[model samples]
Target: MTTLLLAAKAAVAVLLLASGGAKLADLAGFAGTVRLFAPARSSGWVVAAVRHAAVMIAAAELMVGAVSLCWPALTWVNLAVLTLTCGFVIAAGLGYARHRGRPCHCFGALTKRGFGLSSLLRAAVVLAAAIASCMPVRPAPQLHFTLVFHLLLLAGAVLMAAAAAAAAKALLTQPDSAGTVA
Candidate 1:
């Protein structure tokens, strides 16, 4: 069970890192998704606000995920992840209901999945993983990571984020089936 919990935690952390990095790679695309949820406001400030919000959301995910992965002992980080997962679930449901076939850009150009049942299902799975990660592991002392280990973990997290960003950027620049940039 402890091993399962640890795996769950790592899975969600990696997901967050990848999603955040991908979003950062295509902020304009992610901003469009954010604009969808906005209160139908059409103003310069509103556009700027949505862009800022998208950037902040991506940054928060990256920071929280990196911290959680590098220091699993911080139990509060589990709850933080759970909270973020809850938001994702809500967004997924809302996006599915309101924007059926619209591309969510949830993973930037790395994925072409639109707002639909698949999106909802994926969000649910992520939520489940996050919940499982919050479960208490027995004899926590059995895993005592040193400062060096934590630093190494952090480095790996950064690398994962950078790779995801690079992949998304490449996908964004590539021509689509219609001979248009994605």
Candidate 2:
């Protein structure tokens, strides 16, 4: 049970870290996405505000990941994960409904995917994982296998992040038939 819990914590941590890192890597791109989602008309103030918000959101995700990784036993970390995932799910759902054709810009420049059902589904899965990780279970001694497993999971997350970046760079650079960036 402890092993399972630890694995879940590690998985979420890796995901959060990757997401935060990606946003930080391409703050300008992320700000553009934020502008697309914003209801207000684009202006100097709006652009600056979106940029700041993007940084704050990325920082929060990184902090959550760090806390979860460093103190897996802390229930608050799991709770924070769950809360953040839920918020993301709601935001994504709304974005999908309101902005049908705009790029999601979810993982920064890691993908040009649009916000849609898939976004909600992904968030749902992450929310479930966070919930399961938060559930009470009989505590057991941490084992070497757990450490190895989490390390592998983290590596997988990194690979996924790299793949996303490559895909976005390749796909997003191309223009649509209308000569607009897709």
- Each model's TM-score, in the order given? 0.94, 0.74
Question: lDDT, candidate 2, residue 89?
Answer: 84
| lDDT by residue (tens digit), candidate 1, 17-82 | 999999999999899999999988588999999999999999989998998899998989999999
Instruction: Please give the CA lDDT of all the candidate structures.
Output: 0.90, 0.71
- Residue-level lDDT tens digits of model 2 in 1-182: 66676677778777887777677666777777677767666668877889999888877887787667655656777888888888788778887788755666667766656777888788888877788878775643342236666576456655655654455455545553222466
Q: Against the true structure, whose TM-score is highest?
A: 1
Clashing residue pairs for model 1: none
Off by over 4 Å in 2: 140-182
Model 1: lDDT equals 0.90
